[model samples]
Target: MVDQVTSILKEYSVHTDNKMNEIVESRKRVGHLYDMMKYHLGWMDENFNLSRASGGKQLRSTMCLLSCEAISGDFNKALPAAAGLELIHNFSLIHDDIEDGDEKRRHRDTLWKVWGVPQAINTGDAMDVIANIAILSLEDTVKPKVLVSIMKVFNDMVIRLCEGQYLDMDFQTREEVTVDEYIEMISGKTAALIEASTGIGAMIATEDADIIDRFKTFGFKIGIAFQIQDDILGIWGDPATTGKSAKNDIRNKKKSLPVLYAMQTSAEKEELKNLYRKETLTEDDISRIYDILTAAGSLEYTQSMANRYKDEAMSRLEGLYPGSEPMKKLHEIGKFLVERDY
Candidate 1:
């Protein structure tokens, strides 16, 4: 189903791919640094060998181009922005893997693990700079005034993304993180980028702020729902499919939505709390936490919240581009985000 939704993006793949390659190749003076970026992007390996390391689903870039097409805009004109959004998304992921001490991504060693943290941080920063450069290239494709406005939106989103990451790391140390706080954190950490992708797409495609706002709203709501489902997958998804243990997030003591909900509503809150405080959790302790989470109905609660957000996203999409093929594609993507199990 997601493949169906993403098929609309097939048209823009070459454009975005070319832009990504160009961005990485632009800094030939820092060849080694760009090699790291390419490695992380799965274009090459740590030894610069050609291998098929998955570079993720490129969801942000697809949404950007789709949002542009939804407004009857030429997706080719939006290619730079699409590439920019993907770069920013990957930039965040590179840093996030470091912050989370994640050793692997896509079943390969993370950039930070392969390169030291300092070098990995440099590569992430380079990706961000490349992202900004990519967005600025839109000046040739869009009106100068419009490009400036889009840059403002892009810059503002960068700050929010960092703030959200800050809050996420902060939650790990604090004993309590309310559901509301978790929502706010994810709004910045995850949803903001998605919103920017859709919002920038609409911004480039049309001059109507109203339509742009609608796209932003649609992306934001669906992004929240997407992240919530990811949280669920972090806990209960099959490791074979997800490529990580179901208990991975729990072992890291991530304050995911389900855990927060369970902490607030579970009768065994104290036990769960004590379990979290421990430096290490035994297998039995992980099972107990799962039991408590289930007993508290946390999974259902999280899914209900995700469904509510998806409903809102669909409503916004309807208003944004009624009965259009692009709208249908966007709607299907939203459904896939919520419905994907792995």
Candidate 2:
């Protein structure tokens, strides 16, 4: 799947390069800022070195093309939007890592880790600008009205992402967290952009409001399932397959789903409460905590929730009648995300 997506992106390099080159003329004075962004993007290093595969999965771009195909539209016409979605996703990641004080992503040092926080922040800001500007490329292919819809979806996605980030940070301080808030927070932080990517793809394909609505719903459910699975892996997954420490989230003091569940459980709630207030939870503490969380069925509960969302999403997609090959790919992708070991 990765290779296939890689090929599609390689085949569409003109769109990527054309748009990036176009940004140069309008973005002078901040030229070094753009250079930093490019380095982070894997185009060149800080010392002006070129490399390959520096960026991650480009999932948003895949969603864009898939959404178009599901609607029986030529994905070729949607290249600009495809690139725009990918750019937006990457822009978010660059900012998200800094905001979370995360030092690693894609098994490498984060942009902020390599550069200072201020430069990384500005670099991320430039990427955000580029993402918005890239979306405007749809102007030539679609009507002004449709363009407005595209921008609306993309803008709302960016705003909701911020709101979700705020919720995640806030959750850290509060002892109490509802399941509803977790769902809503992941929906914004992780799912919003994906939902927009697919929904915008639908927009590029047709004018059917009901179809677009369903796609938006589909994207949200997929995003939720995707995030839940990530939470699951963050705790129980093998470091090699998952590309992260087995207890990374636990070590970082993250209030993930399982941790919250354990805290709220009947059997092991007090056990969780006893250790959670420590200045720094030791490895023994983490082990004991993991035991309590598992005993409380937090792991089971999280997996079940992710499966429920996956089933719901697939159910909706099945109801949508027109199951094109691209739609099948979307279904398969969702299954892969939910069922993946890493």
Candidate 3:
């Protein structure tokens, strides 16, 4: 399934990348500002030399284009939206790294770490504007009414994404966070854009409100599952595969699902709370926390939750283009999101 999804992504990624590059490169040069954006996109090195590097999996954009292709039998009409979604996702990542104090991404120095926070913030803002511009390009391809609808969805997604980020950061300072609160945070922070991606794609392909709603729900459910998988990987993923240290989430004192569940149900809740209150944690502290979470079955609980969402997401696709290859690929992508090691 992984290989199948990889092949599907490879088929679409080239066109998506080309669209993004065209949008980025067509801009007026402004004294290394664009260079920073390019660097962050893995198109150039810090020295400003062109280089081929992994930007990311392009999951959101691929989903968007795939959704369109699944219904319309073509993805070209969705290219602008795909490019816009990818740029929006990356723009959020730049700001998120600064806010979270994460110095590394994909094994490279983060944008803020490499170029300083002020410029990085400016660069992120520029990328966001560029994303908006990319979406506006849809005016040439889609009807004005359709263009307006896509813009509404895109702007609403941006608002929800910001709200989610706020809740996530706010959770960092609070002593306690409920599972429902965590779900709300991730719904905005991680899932809103994904929902918009598929929803917008379906809009481009057809005017069937029911079909669009199904795709939106599918994206939303899978998006939630995706974040759960991410939280799992943050705590237990291999450093080599994830490009971060062991138990990096613990090192950063993140209140992810596992920690929250253990805090609520673990026999050693008091000790765990005390450990989390410390200004800093040692290797021993991290090890003990790991044991507590494991003993409390937090990992199993988290995985079960992820599977529940994944199953719900799959249900949205039943009977929709029953034998379409793109639909099958979308299913594979959903499984990959929950099962991927990194």
Considering every candidate listed, which one attains the maximal lDDT? 3
- Residue pairs in clash, model 2: none
Residue 215 shift from truth in candidate 2, angstroms: 1.0
Give stretches of model 2 more than 4 Å off: 1-30, 319-323
Go through the candidates in order and give the C-alpha RMSD of each one to the true structure.
Answer: 1.6, 2.5, 1.3
Question: Which candidate, 1 or 2, has the higher lDDT?
Answer: 1
lDDT of 2 by residue, 37-136 (tens): 7777667666757655456656667777778877855777677777677777778889889988888776667888988999898888878888888889
lDDT of 1 by residue, 209-306 (tens): 78888899988999999999999999988898777777778877788999999999899999999999999898899898989999999989999999
CA lDDT scores, all candidates in order: 0.88, 0.79, 0.93
- Model 3, runs deviating above 4 Å: none
**TM-scores for every predicted model:** 0.95, 0.91, 0.96
Give the candidates in order of lDDT, highest first: 3, 1, 2
